[model samples]
Target: MMGLENGITDIPYEVHSSEDLGRYLIAARDLMPGDLVLTERPLVFAPKALPDPEACMPCVGCYKPVLTDVGERCAKCGWPVCSGNCPGLRDVRHHAAECEVLSLRPDCVLDNMAEYYRHDALLSLRCLLLQKTDPENWKKLLEMQSHMECRTPGTESYDEADEFVVQYLMNNFINKFDGKLKKDVPESSKAILHRICGIVDTNALEIRLQQGTELLGLYSNTCVMEHSCIPNTKHSFVHSPKDKNDVFKITVKIVVPVVKGSHITTMYSHALWGTQARRQHLKDSKYFACKCQRCSDPTELGTYLSAMKCLGDGNNPCDGIHFPEDPLDDESDWACNKCKVKVSSSQVNMLISQMGEQVDNVQMMGGSVPTLENLLCRLSTFLHPNHYHIYSIKHSLVQLYGRQPNYMSQEYLDKKIKMCNDLINITKTLDPGNARLSLYRSVLQHELHSALVLTSKKANSDGSFKSDEDVKALLVEAKTAIEDALNCLKDDMEETAGKKLYAVIEKTKKEFEKYCKEKQLNI
Candidate 1:
């Protein structure tokens, strides 16, 4: 195997001897905290899904990734005015193109726009976005329509069609499966939509996704990441205003040591559950029987806190199954149900029929919806909180409660934030660059600031701008909330972090000015 030579060949790595693993010398590899393992071009670049886009606002003046719906246009020049008659996204060239398509069949425009945009936007808009970002690609993309143009015969649009296939294949076209040889595909199409198998090996790519997308989750597609029972990385999405891409971008980071040949993994979702529960989730989403080491173990490599003692007497849990007391235990011990013999983990598994009787009483769907609190309770009894299951469960508790501000009271809110703060400490050690964890901490801290405001306001006799002290305290709380939010999100400047900070700054500035204008505020 012609492996990658270390970039620093002049100063080779020092191979050290270790008594452990029965090895005289260990082959050491250097993977710095932020080493770039590999990055392939995006597999697919279709417009991201947008739900309930802002109204027809000219985006040119609004900035690259603005969210407002309406903008005005100057009627004289046929350009954007400001808010109301926002200019078309692009200048005349783009609008002229939109007009041509709308003109082809005026009736089709509305429906086409409706169908395209309802998931979030119209075809005209998607085209505009594509044009704005990659104008060259968009120009070439325009040629695609010629193949489908009304005057043209409905033949295989060889020219326009070729480019579409190429783009599609560039981002997808993995060959992990057997059979269906590349040579068997159409000759003309094969040249561009080439075999994508092993372009970036799936195993290594999973790790790469962890580093690149896990934190911000900025990129979506084959890169749409999933987590694992034993996760190697943690991630979250960051939304930024300065970004050219409109979609919320995700960022990620490694949370553990990933070795060569180890399948680098990230949890698609929370990994609070035991092996069975986690496997069922992947099975549902990815539709693959996880043969990963974690999934392969019935005990989940001893992480299955919920594993029951099928042959136990319910006391202290059980010493060894009492022979006559539990006939099932004896029966499974390579003997009769009433006979006495020790049982194996396999026997403990086969006797699972006894555990299912309780399943009918539980609300979880094949165990899909276990509460993190409950999972935590189980883990508390069976594993350490630092255990992967506990880590996942603890984070879930923080995320669920933190997001739903309306539901919890001051006391509950305090506890939730505290949990997240603790989680922050843990993540700092495990996944220091985990953006979601940072966002989670940011939210909790912001909420805590809210709680502080409420407390201060409660102490005041009346919520009014009457005195300097009242206004000062209120402004302080506002400033603190904005600062906490800004601090947590500052690292993720390219996405939501930037948008949120911009919003906070705007709000804080507006409030500060408003408060100064008032007589004196109490609340």
Candidate 2:
């Protein structure tokens, strides 16, 4: 029998055709929660940069040329520093929290990189750097990620608290550890703790905000984490504020209980469906016939046993799949969630074609607010969660919500901001530049600011609270949001999937930046 010794140590698992997932299965060992999973350095980790890329433009926090393809490494700390005015270098809050780790790992280089791992030679090395910086936290996070993944993904009580903690550590470490202390510790102790955290990204910024795909988890040795239809982990990319650079990291939450040997799975598809649909997805993309308990019920604990996303108005279009249906055509019709009836294929195709064209227009006319929204609603009707175009659509939507030019409503702003928040969790898998997301996030941020302003105005007439404090909060948000979008163009879209996408990202960044600066903002 092919047992653990016979090259089947990890139990039965299917590797997807899209990736070399099985390649990371380097050795046979009993998988455990918080086990030291395989870690490797990527062979190619260059940021997305176009020729004549924008040179370091100091980040708002410290007027330093945030390190990027064109930035520099600090003399004292290997951590990237922007330039002479780089406050990131002199920030006391950061120095003490970061120094010890920097002292221990002399050659430990925090790089802003992109690309795939061609080999495992540097896996141990990278892990060593992680271990050196914060062995306890790194070990804890990997374990948390593995253990929670053993539980189901979406069903568990969602907790943002744990997600934020893990996110704070990894993202900050990568971003050159520039986070201000969460608590108001004494300046001396804060410096010490900051040294412990080291120079890295605060994760205060992210390019992508989506959860890690099952496909990406394969990048780490922790693939043995159990599959949950709904996952606690979310992955994304961020550029270092200290030294401008873009690299992505995966984030996980401790909200779920993870038993050892359970394969961690995320709701790789959209969250709007039941177990059967999610299982079919797992089977198709991941190549695993999921025996997860949810699949046995198919309706996901009766969640979608009798529902439909598009069957209300008696226009049940292409709701279900027709065998031998053409992928290039369309499947944008509705199906009875209860009865399992679908619309005709021809009609579905018609809808899909219209939406696709709508998206193209938004991309073409990036500055148009109305056009972007029209494109978003149409795609939300068909595409699965984290679909590529959703990145483009959501980014546009977030921007529009902020600057409604007129008739800005607080209700829609709340709805749209939450929408971007959820979508960002999914985008972590699809878009790493966070810059791509910056545009959308900016919109949501602006809308939220508008809401606060409206609230302050209402409070003013009623004398409920101080409008100055409220206004400052609102103004800061608007600046942060706008800065996020500008950062993308400034960073030059230097992160992409393949070489072709990389080129496209850089080109878009440059042209967009040029387009904006020329428009001459009042600032």
Candidate 3:
């Protein structure tokens, strides 16, 4: 096959299309891990249509949070803006046009404004504005698959969103812009509006803004990449500095090496989700059944992420794992790997549902280690050690151990260390290079370092040199692990959690070096 290149020469991937998969991206040349495969600027991005009330409110123009409710509102439109001097508000193509329309609407006047009018139409309206202001970008957006036929008019997803677009947006805003403009408002056809909404729903990526508020971004190029449960490339959104224009850029990097001609993929579903859950999400949201390698494998690449415990005997539980006989079939039987005991898929589903409810209840109680521990013990009766549900409880414990009151005892710390290590191993096999794995690895290293320091202090108080060599060796190990975590997190420091963790790890490194010097050990 011949390679086709876009205007950007540095991008290693090119878009390709087929009847079955539609448009997908393929690597034009060999790409190593951490190599930049593509960089994309969003054609039209906006805050989520209906964000949680508790979420920070973002500026209408730039999508950055105003930090306080009292921040500046546009003089003409009365919508949130960072400041009167905000550059985004001055852009003729975007905010200036939006302000002009809102200024003409008497219902949008500050005192007469309704709550529904403020939010329900912003995203779709922004998209409409893009069509008028940037025709080239609108053309690019129209090339994307909207899957409009699948989004039938009566469907729940289509009904509410379509009503909001037609009633609140087109009627209240676009059609009403009649006599107020020097130029007449562009006619937005219902068919075109429906197609735009479908495109946004199908391909928009969830991105975090500068103040950590989430927004939906529609990238012209990156939207064409296919979804995979085991994706080779990872993508992150970087916000432009305040000095620069408020443009957001997505950087796609290969997490695993890709040979020339291999298709570059990105994940749409959560990495930690099981095959069944991932497939269901893809089917519902993207309108396709994913037959990815990870989804087809019963053992989930040997991590047994969806395994259940075998019920062999009342006295001694079977050490076997239970998995779906045919993972692709929702009604497939679940069979034990060792005992060959088969159970109907319905029975297995019911058990999992009950367990999930119980887990949700425990999570709602929040930070109760004893409650979580008791629940984990009870769940062990029916769930295999490597099951996703069991891993969820263990994952909670890792966060609770040292932070909770009275849970920092040496015994608990040791248990925490072991659980963190186990989770790290599971993640390495199933979700390696994931941001969560880097976090767990960092937590484990920190806990180990703390434990070693305490042990060395106790031993020194008792005048013992036996543990000196052991402590030194452990300190080196902890130091090395933190270094690995630092490397993993170097590119992610823009996030709040990453920033705090980066500071903590940097301080810990200095402390480790100081301790080594005091002990006269060359580590």
Candidate 4:
């Protein structure tokens, strides 16, 4: 058995294999919420598959964004690099071995290449080259489960265009390596190249490196954890402060308690997404039909995340949630819980698609308060108040309420406070202990502090404070809220959102203390 490394102990987790599911991770003992479970470094890391037109020139070694106009390029191959003598480029990077091979191959030339073909083959090429230089790491990679045989035309995993790119890498690149590399490579076989591509597609996680660049990282042990719609654990990528540009580690923590022997799983699909959308995305990307509890429940654990508002022409609209007749089948009819009215799956699909487009447009408007409010009002005509679409809009509104220009009024701050509290309640049921929950709680506390301070100031100016006790009470509430916000934000300081919240909370606390001293109240 492969044991946990890096001083990870008392984790209460074990690795197991099954005939049907291959390898998976399970809890060996009872695990509780907020427990640290595991940490790992990637076996192989490469840039993500960027859209052809949207591809930016990131450094080949550390994956840092490097502008083409002034950035350095590799001396031999002319690919993006931090500097000619960069430590990663000189001796330790993946680019060192492939640079010479790419420099000689006629078809491997980088100039005037199409956008789609730029990054599609880079990860596979890196894996193949690793076999020559880092044999042990290559061997570990080969042990991974790659569902290459299942990539058929009729299946959800099929992608004809990507497959063509894999073929090009094998025929035009790998098969034409330099004589030195050719002798080092075991065999210039397309089958091996295909398997490498399949492995990356199946198991790679999107790592958000420093400076906001995203890359694909392959973790040997963490990859074995299965997917769940409502996952028990969450993972975060922590970049090394000593070398922020290149080094990163994945930290997985338990978000919910689990019994001994229960499977330890993480979310592949977003927790906020509707059931149908989440399941469809899993099927298309991961090549699996999810039968998790959330997928099986028609009401989605009574959250009604996918419900549409009934358009009945009667005196009262149908007070019912709409759900699929058979939760597992996409073509199943949808029925109303109260009116017993049925809607075709095709119709529901069309409606959702159209609404999704509108939501995208509103999101693209840069989270303006009026624009989001208008969008929410329009969405309510056809969507339940608690629908994911409406929830998303409200979530955006809460974030923008106090930050936008002309939105810091006392009225607006009170509105923001109420919205934040409401969101916290919903998130407790839908995404408990999520980083988003920490964010929401912090924002709610900050808004509460702002509103209380503003109210206290107005009352004092208007000579409306009946006694000093009233002012003391307001100051106490504001101080407590700021403290709560600080506690919730303690673990998230590395993230941009968390840093911003921390700064705001600290500033507010200082201001509150100053005001308290002015009143001579014991805080």
Candidate 5:
């Protein structure tokens, strides 16, 4: 293999294909954790279109927010933009060709905002423009999987894309001007638009700007990794300061050591979602039923994220947990581990649905420690201790116990510490390298440190400490936890919650050190 690597020496991964797993990335050689697998600029990027059209209003030119009702219109295209001097307005790689195409329409500029702007069609237009502006990238885009057969005419995805994107671009931009383009408009066709929409839906990754504006970005090499419930690769965004054309670049790194010929993986669904939820989301969005190791296990690697408590009949009040007999088979019956009582999938679904609505309502009410605690206590009756729904409520309570007022009792502190430890352990087992659970782990560490500190302070106030050595030990552990939290959040960007918590933890560490020094307790 070493002798065969004659031409490509720098690349760390190679693309491989099979009948079951389409095109996917595989390790080119033995790679260690944190090894840079790939770094690639986006093929194309545009502001994300939301369900609510007014949710995000970024300028098509510079990708900056257009603050006013009627933003500064482009002289050529009559579209909302940040300013006349925005660099992206005239760049051939971005908005220039789209501007030329939009300039051809008779009703290019309209008085009504909704009539004037179609946010959903913006990205499709940008992708279509690539055919003419950047032919090399256009070929690369075509090579990506679109799953157009699965997204046929009558499908919800197909109809939505056709109505919102394809027809909008056609009726407004191309066909509105005598069904002819003046040599500059990128080649547009219904089939091509359908493919582009499918490609964007399947491959685009969400990128958030420093100003909190979210955009969708499609990358060439980064999208090749296959999906897994437990992924071995993690990717982060790097803001490119030197290159203005590519505002954001993504860097993919291995979270665990990989042997040569092994598949490089990334999680496509939320890490906290249970097996059923994760599989369903993957099937609906990416068009696949994932049978990964984590998905196939009924125990979910011992997290029991999908387990429920059995409510046995009055004749035998049994204390047993119910888990799916076959996690891969959605219709399979769930059986109790101890009592051997069986329940149908529909019964479990109905229970989960009812619990889900309650959970949603409580979360929306927002974090009052007492309220969340009460909710968690009630959920414990039906859910396993490590159920995903209970984990959700406990996550809120963990942060709230120490941060909120009137909840600093010794009991609350102990509860906070226990929840932090449990969640950290579960996440560690599920995501060994903290790749997917970095933010959660960071917060858990910070909360654990806070609880330990408060506990020590309470002990001192009550004169219950054995000696200053005990206080010193607690402070030392607290310092170590805060440092670990900081390490977990080191790669977070400036505007993120992790960075903000990083700053808070930094101050807390300094204060702890200072207090220890003043008390003549060296740490």
Candidate 6:
């Protein structure tokens, strides 16, 4: 066991290592829900590679997107910055050290849009620069996991890092520094650069700013927690905007009661992905196969996220659902629980791939009610009602209803209500602790409240709208739903969508209560 550094003492957690789990954080004291377990700023942070060529380029200093045709550039380095006087460009820990390095490559033309995409190397360069500027923190970073062996010469990971990061840095800047080295880069320096790249890839967490600029941040203590599909803790970030000197930091809070010796966990994969998808992602990116409880269960704890309807041959149509016999094995055959009919893993993969493509298409087409409904209708025959694709489509549908004037009909409202209820149930079952799915569940709750409020106004078959008693009952439910939604978003930072939604829902809740008071409809 090693003590945590970076002034991370007196927290309810201890850093422990095991043969199987490597270095991980464990609860040193009993933790209750909402317990503030950890808070730490990034060891290093940098802008992500511009994934969208058509999108505005981000300022290298402050990471804000350059919205105007020609944005401000740093006075010293000539790199894009939100302003010529950006503080981030002056901060020693951020762009200050690298600004010197980038200045060395003055001849390199950065006018091309493709040149902006080279920002992938920016983070690794920052990490490498730490070796000189912040040597102690740099040592701490090297102690983190790199999994270098898994990313050897022939691997795609190796090739990407080698070409984009290591070679770029050496050829453009490092080799030219002081004109001290030969044309050929030294193996030791190259190895360190590669190791830095791996560390960033493995440890960095993806973050999106309020303005929708995406970046990566590597934390010292927070990155040490182990990964779980159903994490016991939820983390929120405090992003620093240009006007605020509030450096970016993260807060990790316990979402469920955990015993003193339990592992402090955080999710590394999307909560909505199926077992295979999650496991494969972990294996590919983190270089480890996840054997978490959720991954081991083929039925995904009965939510059936990956299950498909087992349509038997023409003569004998079976009504069983197909699930992986051994979910941990990538090539495990899928079998029907009822009819015992078997399907190859390849066949199942193909089906999932094809359905996923269709789902993507529908989402790209704006996910309108009619499109999602038609897709859901066609897919309900071949997929379980709770399939992740179906779940995703329904999630889109949940928000679409009541937002548009044409979607306020009884049928759409009914569908929205049903979808909200079903999604809420599935999300809760998968994330019983409500840590990983807080924002998602909050959105569902808000949508459900909206649907209920709208449904209360529809005329009954008897030609009368909802009675005072009925409307009051519905309003009470709506109030509870909004309250829960607000509770889930209470930790969200300002200027975020969650915070805006919270304000809107708070007003809606007041209106609901006001209507009840005016009508004299006491509960």
- Tens-place lDDT digits, model 2, residues 1-523: 2123223344432323223232222223333323322222111111112122233322222323354455665555443345545554454222333433343334523342311111111121222234444454344324322222222234221132123322333333333433332222212232222322121111111232121111111123233334444543333333333434212332322223335434334334444333434555654434455555444542333332212234334554544322212222223334444445556655644654565576776687674656666666666565543444565566566656645665346555665656666554553322333313333433343344344334433444445665555655654554454444344333333233322333444454454345435644222
Backbone clashes in model 5, listed as residue pairs: none
Candidate 5 structure quality by residue, lDDT tens digits, 259-288: 999888998898888898898888889999
Candidate 4 segments exceeding 4 Å error: 4-11, 49-55, 91-94, 106-117, 153-164, 241-246, 313-316, 403-411, 435-501, 504-523
- Candidates in order have lDDT scores of 0.37, 0.37, 0.72, 0.73, 0.80, 0.82
What is the descending TM-score order?
6, 5, 3, 4, 1, 2
TM-scores for candidates 1 onward, in order = 0.38, 0.35, 0.88, 0.87, 0.92, 0.93
Candidate 3 global TM-score: 0.88
TM-score of 6: 0.93
Better model by TM-score: candidate 1 vs candidate 6: 6
Give per-residue CA lDDT, model 4, range 416-522, as digits (tens): 77776666566667666564357776776777677666666654445565466776677788788788779877667766667777997898799788877877778
RMSD per candidate (Å) reads: 14.8, 18.9, 3.5, 3.6, 2.9, 2.8
What's the count of clashing pairs in each model shown? 50, 69, 0, 0, 0, 0
lDDT of 3 by residue, 302-358 (tens): 888888888975566677878999898888998988885788888988888899889
State the displacement of the C-alpha of residue 70, model 1, in Å, after optimal TM-score superposition: 7.8
lDDT measured at residue 478 in model 6 versus the true structure, 0 to 100:
81
> Can you give the lDDT of residue 146 in candidate 5?
95
Candidate 6 has its poorest 10 consecutive residues by lDDT at 179-188
> Which candidate, 1 or 5, has the higher lDDT?
5
Q: What digit string (tens of lDDT, one per residue) describes model 6 on residues 125-239?
A: 8887776667777878888899998999989888999998899888877877763222222322888989988999899987777777778889877888999998999887777
